[model samples]
Structures are given as structure tokens and as C-alpha cells.
Target: MFRTLVQNVPAVADTSDTSDTSDTADVAVIGGGMSGMATALRLQSAGLSTVVLEAHGHAGGCAGYYRKRGFSFDVGATTLVDFAPGGVGAELLDSVGIAPLNAQELTGYRAHLPDREVVLHRDQSAWHAERLRMLGDSERHRRFWALLDRLAQTFWQASRAGVRLPVRGPADALHDLRAVGLSGVPLARHLNRTLGDALRSHSLRDDAALVGLLGMLVEDTVHTGVDDAPLINAALGVTIRGAGLSRHVGGMHGFWRALVTHYRGLGGRLRVGCQVSQVVGGPGHYRLTTRHSTLHARRVVCALPAARTAAICAGLPVATRLQTFLERDAQALGGACVVFLGVPEEEVAAQELTHHQLLQAYDRPLGEGNNMFVSVSASGDTLSAPPGHRAVMISTHTELSGWAGLDPAAYEQRKKEIGERLVGYARRAYPALGERAVIAQTGTPRSYQRFGFRPDGAVGGPRQRLGNTNQHAVPHDLGGPGLWLVGDSTWPGLGTVACVLGSRIVAEGMLREKGFAR
Candidate 1:
């Protein structure tokens, strides 16, 4: 159900303004996140006139940033993965002659467990040694790693080839077949299986600690626990270090600014502080209703949450099946919370902490007071913090139901409690946290709603659980010709890498519709 926040939605009034012709475009992207920017740039590269509409003052969406006092903190995402040569971000940036930010290589995140502290390094050899030293080496562990390695490699290759999900046309279906080739046969074998099933197959299901760790790691990325995590994506989550992960020199916002700069340089028009209220259209064209103007476009790309997308599509000439699917996908998703902190440089230097860390508690649940993913900036990274200060971003998965149905006072109390609990966990993991803590703030799903423009301030896309993987994922096309989705809400799921990949798929779809591709 849509939140009752808006008591009455304004009806779309028919406008016959002749001056509105200036707002028309070959394609209109309905969100200015990384995905929307990528789609607009790619379309322009293909010789199509494109316009981008962003609700926020800037781009980046969930991967955006906020500045307070003299400190800069990430609004949502802290780290970026997939910086390799042929990666999605790499290719996209290269297309516009934009160089990526100077990123520090992340060996692996430090996981603070109940019995031991372990580091999962990017190098396979170092990771193996650390794993054996921490958790007694077992045949089950070896088998699971091997399987994930194979699946992850294949998944990367397929993603690089721009494999579209929930295929809508013959071109996409054929592309999927060609991209997978013979190697992806193994992935097909486990199409219906979950990570829990794989653990059982390897006789590792009895290892409670290992299962708990896997659940902790996956719940952040896949939006589901180990028992329900889809095997294909779970495999990628497990082997995340195999590819590469990095932190931008300034922050996430800097990276987004680079993309936006390159996009505008390529002649793409961006309209910030412009929110599309409804989209009503047919096959070849779309009429988008914004707060102050009614824009017309030959193609519409919605880079937003499923519920929000469904709300707009409800006013369109879309099929019943697609609208129903979007509504259901929205309800199936969870939420996320992030805590930002500013600490003095002296305390951070004394501890010599890594850029990223994952702290997990053995006795409690993952989000409440048990698990957190933390990212700290280098002491002298002036863009994030001054020379004498440091910036820290902490996040955890949360359910929307926990935040709903509360009075204003109760909601504020619950938010404070969660923020304090997360701070406590961070302090425990990094003892120097309290000593240098200068300023602190918390962002909830509602914060995300305000800044990221997602529904209920939800984080991530829908949960990619058992029945929500591969072809079962939400379709990029909501069963409407020339309409598409290109973000975490669609197939390929969440993360910066997935968003870029999904963007390319949507770009390809648009190009095909324009007869630019087969």
C-alpha cells in the first residue's frame, strides 16, 4: 500500500501550452542517479537527444553525499566495487573521457566476530590462509569457495556483455543466450537453489558460525539472509573481493559529479529539483507530469523504486500484469540505515584502521545492535574531513515495518535508540571512535526518501530471494514498449556495479527501439 503521507495526490491536468514543446526530448530519464545519468549519456552517445530529471539538487541518488559543518559524509553507499578495466563504471567513464577518482585498493573488510577477528583479503592466497587460520580448514569450506569462484567469474562476464534480465524482446533473449554461452550452464543448474541449499550440498549447513557469517555478509548486498539468498548473486557476494573494490578520493559524491560533468559535456540536459509526479503514455511516446511543467518524450526510462515506478505507471497505458508485479516487488523489499560520524585525526592515526570494517555480534540480530558495515576516511582527506578530522559512515539493513506506525515522539525515540546502538557497536569495533568523535548524525529510510527519492526511504532493490533470481527478477520493461527501468529495483539487483550494468541494458533496449541496434 502507498504511504498515506500524501493525503490527496493532485490530478494531472491536461496542458495545451505551445511553449512546452521546448521541454520535449528524444528520451527522458525520470531519475538522476548513477543509472539515470549513465542511461542519458549512453543514449546521447548513440546520437539521441536526452534529458534527465532529478528530484534532488544534484545527482548520485542513493550514492550521494551530504555536508555538515566542515565534515562530508556519504548519504548512503560508502564503498564502490567493480573498478577493473572492463567494468561497467570503467567503460561508462571512458566513454566520456572522464577519469575515475583516485581510489585506494581495499584488500578486504575486517570482520569482528565473536571468537576471532578475520580479514578477507582480495588476494585469494591471503584470504585462504586467513580463513584456515581463523576457521579450521574443512573440505566443505573448500568446495563452497570453489563453487562461488566459478559462478562469480561467469556472472562478471555475463554482466560485462550487457545481459538483460526478464527479457522483453527477441534481441534481449538472444543476447542472454549468446552472452552465457556454454560456461553459464552451471549457473542454470542452480537457478532455483539458494545459498542455504549450496551449504547443505557441501555438508556445511551444520556450521552455525559459518552460516551466521555468510548471512551477515549477504544480508547487506542481496537484501536477504543466507537461507533465502539466490545462489547466483550470493556467489558474487561471497567472492566480492575477487573483483575489486575501492573508495573515491573525495567521497561518493565526487564520483557522481564526475559522471554528471562528463554527461553534460556530451550535450545532455540535466534538470535538477524537478520531480516527475506521473507518467501517462502509450507505446511510442510518454507525457511526464512534473511539479511545474509537463514534458513530452519519445522514450521514458524510470530509474526509481518499484512502488514509485508502479505509482507512475498506474497512470499510464501499461498492462495489468506489469503494474501488479511492480506493486508486489515494492512490498517485498526491505530498508537500510546509515550513521555518519566525524572524528579527530589524532585518534584515527593512532589506531591505523582500515578503510572498511564489518562488526558482527553473535547473540543478537543483524541490524538492531548486532551487525554494521563501517567506512572510515583517511585522516588528511580534506574533501571528506579536514586535516585534523576523519569521516566515518556506518550502515545496516532494517525492515520498513519497524519504522512505520509510530507517533512523532515514538519515531524520534526509535531513531535515536538505533543510532546510539550503532554508535556503540562502532565504538566497540574501533576503540578510538569515542575518543575522537566530534560530530554524529543518523539517516533513516525516511532520509533516503527525502534525498534518494525512493519510496518509504527504502534501500536496495527488492530482495533477490529464492523465487526472485534470474528470469524471476523484476522486468526492466513494465510490459510497455519504449518504457524501461535501469537501477537497483530492476534485475541484476543492487550496488553501483549492478546499477551501471542495468543502465547499459536499458540503453541497449532504447537503442534497439530506435533501430540503432538489432
Candidate 2:
């Protein structure tokens, strides 16, 4: 059922610069994911010599893609929202000369609960109006909308101020406080509430549909439930209410390719396939020991996870703290996703599927097969199938801790069973899915580990619960002078936009500290 693998670009040259030219670089960014790439690009554009060391051959990390036959599949992420003009995400893309496609805007998400199915529209008025009309007037719905609006406004303001910078000590904390103080009262109030209390106080506790909605939001944002998450992080998802969802025209991989192109064009150096073995430090500089050679730089940004950062900084003072943070703060939430491609054109014609769909079995446990988020890369006008064929990607949240240490045969059996069950559940929404699938690929936690290098195949990094939501909770400070951290495990947490924003903030802080500020 699979076709030939197509090469998109020529192999990158091995950059094993062993000569000690006495030339110093401004910064060296480890990990070539969106966060690392964005940071390197921003620094280089400021005229600072930057080098991005990516273990993988291509850039984009989780945001990258691979091609099979004629189809391009986004292996890591698929959906994006809040890309409107002037938004940080949009501005970043625009600066890189990557424009959003004029594709059809998704109305909203469709929820398939065990009891019923509901289609969520992008228009707030329309969405609320429909809910009230169908479920009757409930004070819960009214209060929910009001809270959503308030939270959305506050988050929009905060995001506009630019992502917060890394804080080193009490002095940095005071600076951050001053910045927040200048923003005024609303910001303070918004950060003071927990998402759980917000929902319970509004009488939304008994509403299954409302719970499902908030649950999905929580899952996508924190990789956990609302009760365990902080109000500030949850508010980030609520704030995306009316912003139209977007996707790259070809696939998400197209977006990654565009970023690499822009970065290379700016005269930035990118070394791929060279694994960094150790990061050693001298009197005032740091050197990266890779398989081929060593790269010495004045400043280094550890853009990978805290665990991997610990591995690289073996001889550094912060190594112990980094390891602790990785164990406690960087614990992974287990989950797996399966991508289905090559469904014939005729089957897609019968089932009118859109670019996205959400399937749920309400009675099931939260981490089980209860909720499944699906996205189709088909044409905009038609939801079910791509222009001539059909492509579907489905994902569910599972605890990686539960699957660890299992025997190889048992692990394979579990994957096969889960894959079949998920496909069966999807068949209920699109009956034609049964006989139409021509290519099926199952990605277990092992697959994620193999491809993304996530330790336990944890797609989401560190749970955004109450105690771990603060600035210090993030391993950004590293407790050392020159070492820094940036990624999904850092402040602001998961999602492509959040990761990029966090990385930018770290880069800006480093620039300011090094006297490169405007």
C-alpha cells in the first residue's frame, strides 16, 4: 500500500569545523525545531553570527514533514489557529516571506460525543446562539461565553506585549513585575483564577458538552485536564475563540521548508545529521563536541528538552539541576497518533468530510479512546477527501508511563489493537472509511521516540498543572551563567505558536544581556 520515498532537497554538507580560527560566534542554538530555528533566525537577522546545530537532517523538529509517493504528510502537527494579520505567529511567517494560503477557513470543530454530534462554528454569536437554541436557555452557557470573552481579551493583550523573557533572579522578577504593572488591572485579575474554578463557579460543571469542549482545549494546550491546569494557560486556548484556523497549502511540511529556505538565505549556517556528544566549557567560552568535530562559541542556547540538555552539559555546574528538572518538570504525557492516507476519490465523494473532525466515545475513560481529534488535508471546499483522494490523521492522549518496560511482542500487539479500534471508531463518522483506506501507518510512542527523539514518545512535554505553571517552574533560568533552555518544556508551554514565542523571548533576553539591544 506504500509508494516510493521522494527526496525533497539535497543532503546537507557535513560541517565539521575542527580548526581553531580564533573567531568567536555570538550564539549557538542546539535543536533545529521551530523554537531553535526561530531563535537562530531572529539573532542572525540582528547581524549576530549564529549557528544552528540540528541533530536531524531537516529543520522544523516536530513541525517538519516527509513525502510518500505523491502525498506529503505532516508527521508532527497539522492544525493552526490565531494566524490573523498583526498576530505574532503571522508576523513571524511574514518576516520569513511565508504567507498563509487563501484556503477555506474552518468554521470550527465538530464534536462527536456518545450521546450526540455537534458542529462548532467559528462565529461566536452563531455558536452560542445554536447551543442556546438546541439545549435551551442555561445560565451556564451565558456565563461561559462572558468568561471566554474576558479571558480572550486579556491573553490577546499579553501576547501582544510579546512573550515574557527569562528571569535570572529577584532583579529580573522586578523587571517583569514592572512590565506587567504597566499593562494595567485586567492582566492581574485574569492570572489570579484557576480554570477549574472558572468553570465550576459558572455552573458549567454539569454540562457534558461544555466539559467536552473545555477538555479538548485543555488537552491541546496543557496535555491534561482543566482542573489540573492553571487559568493563564487555559485562557490561551479560550482566547483563540474567533480566530480562523489555518494550514499550509501543501501540508505543514511546506511551512517548515519555507523556514529553512528563509534562514539559509539570510546567510545563517545550519549543520544537520551531526549529533552533539558533549558541551565542554573553558574559561569564558563553550565548545560543542559532535561526532565529527567541535564548535566553540561565546554563548549557547540549549533548545532541546531539559533531559537532553543535561546530557550535553555533562561538565557544567547546572548539570545536576538540569537533571532534576528533567525528571520532575519535563515528565512526558504519553500519547500516540496514526496517519491514514490514500483513500480513493469515490469513497471521499460519498462522505462529506472537512479539513478537521473530532470523534469521541463519551462513556470511555479520558485517556483511553474517549476523545479523538482528526484532521483531513483534503481540499478546502470538500471535507471528506483530498482533491482526488482522502487523507486522515487521528490522535488520542495515552499515558506513556503505562506502556514503558513492556515486552516487544506485547507492545506490538497493543499498537495493533489500538490502531484497529481507532479506525473502527472513525468508521462510525465516515462509513466509507472501512473499505477506502489504501495506506495505513501506526505511530506508537516508539515511533515518536524514533522520529522526534522524545524520550518516552511523549508528544506533549511536562504537564501544565498548578504548581508548575509559574516562570520559575520552567527550567529557563538553569541556575548557571551561560546555559539556557527553550522548547515545549519551557515557559508558555506546548503548541507551535507558544514554543516559537518562548524561544523568541529567550533569544531577546540573551541579546539584551550581551549588549546587542537596539
* Candidate 1 residue pairs that clash: none
| Model 2: lowest-lDDT 10 consecutive positions | 1-10
**TM-score of each candidate structure, all chains considered together:** 0.91, 0.88
Q: Write the per-residue lDDT of candidate 2 for residues 1-518, one digit (tens) a residue.
A: 11221234324323433443434566788888878888888878777788888776567666665555455666666766566676667766665565564444566766675666666667878876766665447777777666766666656555655646445568666656654555444555655567787888887766776676667767766777777767777867754546556666655655665676677777788877656779888424888877766787877888886667777787887678766566666454556566455566655455454543454644445654556766667554232234577566666777786678989889888877777877777766666764756677666777667766777777656877766665546656563556667887777767777776776677667767644453
Clashing pairs in 2: 107-122, 334-398, 334-400, 353-383, 353-384, 354-383
What's model 2's lDDT at 345? 61
- What would the per-residue lDDT of candidate 1 be over residues 114-206, giving only the tens digit for each residue? 767777788888987887677658877887878877888887788777777877669777888788777686577877889999999998877
